[model samples]
Target: MAELEPEARDRIMDVFMARYNALHATDYDRFEDGPKGTDHDYLCVSSSGKAPLKVQHTRAWADPETEWRVPKDVERLIVHALQRRLDERKICDRHVSIRVDSFPPKRREKLALLEKIWMAVEFGLNRDWSNPSLQRLMRYERNDWTQFYQPISPYVAELEILERVPPVQAPALVGWSATGEEGDGVQDAVFRTVEALKKKEEHYRGTSADLVLVIDFEVMPYFQDELERIRAALAARSIDFREVWLVSQWLPVSADQVWPAPNVQSADAP
Candidate 1:
């Protein structure tokens, strides 16, 4: 693949930063100590630098003008940014730290709706339904029609901390929940694998070296929005890696230089 132009890289970074804001939305007003006790922004710090790279000291929901286009859910937005970074093959070693907390009441409600819609849609398409009518009801739930509500959350937000990992150890890391025909196959698989990896990583203190792999599966485009939300969800989690790589048939190209990605991991056994 060809290199990403500086403009493209900037756009990718913008997306990465905004996505992080969306994912880290939490309830800050509810904190008794106010903003100090609450993590109102997506906090990213590069510890290696003499001074940290500070993007802004503002919340994803607030701008000088009106609020952001996206309502801002911490998990959904951050993961979306991270996923974009991975898709572009931009994995850095900049000792980056991300913290998403402090959401408004409405933002919390929006997140719940997004998650519920996503799960409902995923179930309708991926799981078996003896009665198609019930499945349809779940897909077209009542709350879906409410104002300021959407089936999927907008994949945008604010940028707090930005750090680019070094050029070395840029191996890609693409995680998918592997659930589909066999009860939400790819999504389930990827979710299970990540959960297991998380447990194992914590268990071994991040010392496992097994080449991650996935079984066969397919998903309909009917749930593209849901998939995007799911991707955002996974990205929000602060998963660590020394030299991680993400490989997928959907986006086989690591052409997005802003992501700092290495070669793709093979689906077949290495």
Candidate 2:
């Protein structure tokens, strides 16, 4: 795969965002030319203006969002975009594609993964690449690499291979992953909720009534020790869990029905 031309990168994002707006009509609205603190080409929000979720703006997939393994070409676009953010906090929206930073290979690799391990974990894109319908979220037309969204797909399936979601005698935890991967800081996330509730913080009103934790597959190892503690605390609280899903692992589906992806072979990459 060759690096994404600046034109291709922008177009790809526009297509995904267009779909995003159509799907999240009530929940989000899209914007261009970057919003105040966002510093990216696109921004969207719900909740009277909150962080946007997938379809995560493509550039964001390289920033506050976790990084994934990408083909060399598309990876170049991400590097170029991040440089603008790290340097001037400005992105040129015209004819600017196909630039890979000249960092030592190791340094670039570290930077690529740096955006990961933040809070949420992702999987499944590669799993369904063989399916044509899933192609948009998995294989890229511009670079034949993986496609991912920030905030994860709200529709991802949660397969509880082991631990069951705790009934919350408490409220859902009120923090993003401090470390990217949810399990790494699962305890902190839980304790944060406990503290807020104990203090009777009005802002946390009604949280004590339920706890919803979204754990990612990568966060699994971190849970090896603390999952039990979390379960015990929630058990004490008797909060009913809303849902527990393994995100990005299964073919996507919305509240209405599952989306079918077209089956395309790797040989089909242009």
Candidate 3:
């Protein structure tokens, strides 16, 4: 997983605050980046002149190892390698997007993975597009782009190939999944959430301001059950935080309150 750029991080905080204000009927409208090397990420101030809240954002990863592996770097490596191959072959007929399923852990295996992906792309290009079943998968409205699903390659899980629209200066590989693995469901979410909370609890102990732990769900899939499971897990432990929120990265964005469990009210509950 890549570190969020400052602008991107601020934008996510803005979205979370918007949802938070609407849900809680609070007027938190201003935000400032917390001092560098501090315990919190941002200081949020309300219109009512209430004390600024110390907010810290931590993303929940389905596979925590991604922080070190850096999946985005792998995607860039694949894209650059594929583009170079296309240029070498002088084959600029279409634009393709690849969804990687898995990449080998070892360096030697990764080199082999690139070759396998190119082979899969070449196979997809030569595929009979006029076949009835294949034609059904075409996006007629979107430049007649056809999808090729997992073409016998362990590396390339999906390929979206667009043809007969417009010739470009170069063929491009446009999209890839954040982490190729599928979500492990609510239990995984609960575990990750608890892990994030515990990590933050240890780091930011005795901070004066109210803490808002925002669990980013961009890399991890979101499920309704995750909310209840997180609430239950939090109730079982004694953690220090004024609020806990689950924020989604997808459209129609949502920030769900997960702490202050309805069944187990905190002494500080208003």
Candidate 4:
């Protein structure tokens, strides 16, 4: 895995602190970069004048080697290209969904594939099923938007049109691909989290401030039960971190505490 730049690392810490504060109802305000050669990554301070915490952030990947195999920028390129075509055609009333089976590695091939997709969508929209029998069948199954299956290439597989319920100022395209490995993904998540914990333990050992390990689950698939298994695995190992947090950077963003055993009640508890 490549090392995170100082600025990039700070951005991750910023998001982590925002979510952490919301989750725990704490007043942590900001963080600063730790001194060079220090064990921790940043020193997070609280607005309420509590002791500052030394935070160490790390990312875990199911398969680090293939994490960047498909460049996200390419996906964005496809969306933008299609959006421009939609604007040119005055298709501003609905939305589009694209399911990609694979993407060509070459740039020219990708551009060609995009053109074919737009042409197919255009043709499908203007096509008139004039046969009396077919027209009768269409009346019964009328839809707000048209759908098309364009086998443009091995790269681009399917294209679907969706009617905007409330209508929109402009049409939008949502693109997705099946990039996850087949499985429940619990074991992979657990293995990645545990590996990250082990690697950070030595770096944060014997530190005066509290140690925090933040695991990124943006690409890794998991659920609540996966968190339980991860917690159990970490608790069995002797580690240095005071707390462990799992963070997701995608939509419906979340930050969860997986350490300190949430079920373990304090002796002074009521």
Q: Taking the tens digit of each residue's C-alpha lDDT, what string does model 3 give over 50-84?
A: 77878888877645655425466566677778777
Which candidate model has the greater lDDT, 3 or 4?
Answer: 3
* Residue 14 accuracy (lDDT) in model 3: 78
Report the lDDT tens digits of candidate 1 across residue range 134-153: 41212221234333223332
**lDDT top scorer:** 3
The residue pairs found clashing in candidate 3 are none
Error of 4 at 172 (Å): 6.4
- Candidate 3 ranges beyond 4 A from true positions: 1-3, 23-25, 67-70, 87-175, 178-188, 205-209, 221-226, 262-270
Report the Cα lDDT for residue 27, model 2.
47
Instruction: Compose the digit string of candidate 2's lDDT tens values, residues 37-117.
Output: 432333444655755542212111212122233334334434343334434522121111121122223656545543431
Minimum summed lDDT over a 10-residue window in model 4 is located at 135-144
- Listed in order, each prediction's TM-score against the native is 0.19, 0.19, 0.66, 0.59
lDDT score for candidate 1 against the true structure: 0.30
The regions of model 2 sitting more than 4 angstroms off are 1-6, 26-30, 35-41, 44-270
Comparing 3 with 4 on TM-score, the higher-scoring candidate is 3
Lowest-lDDT window of 10 residues in candidate 3? 135-144
Q: By TM-score, how accurate is candidate 3?
A: 0.66
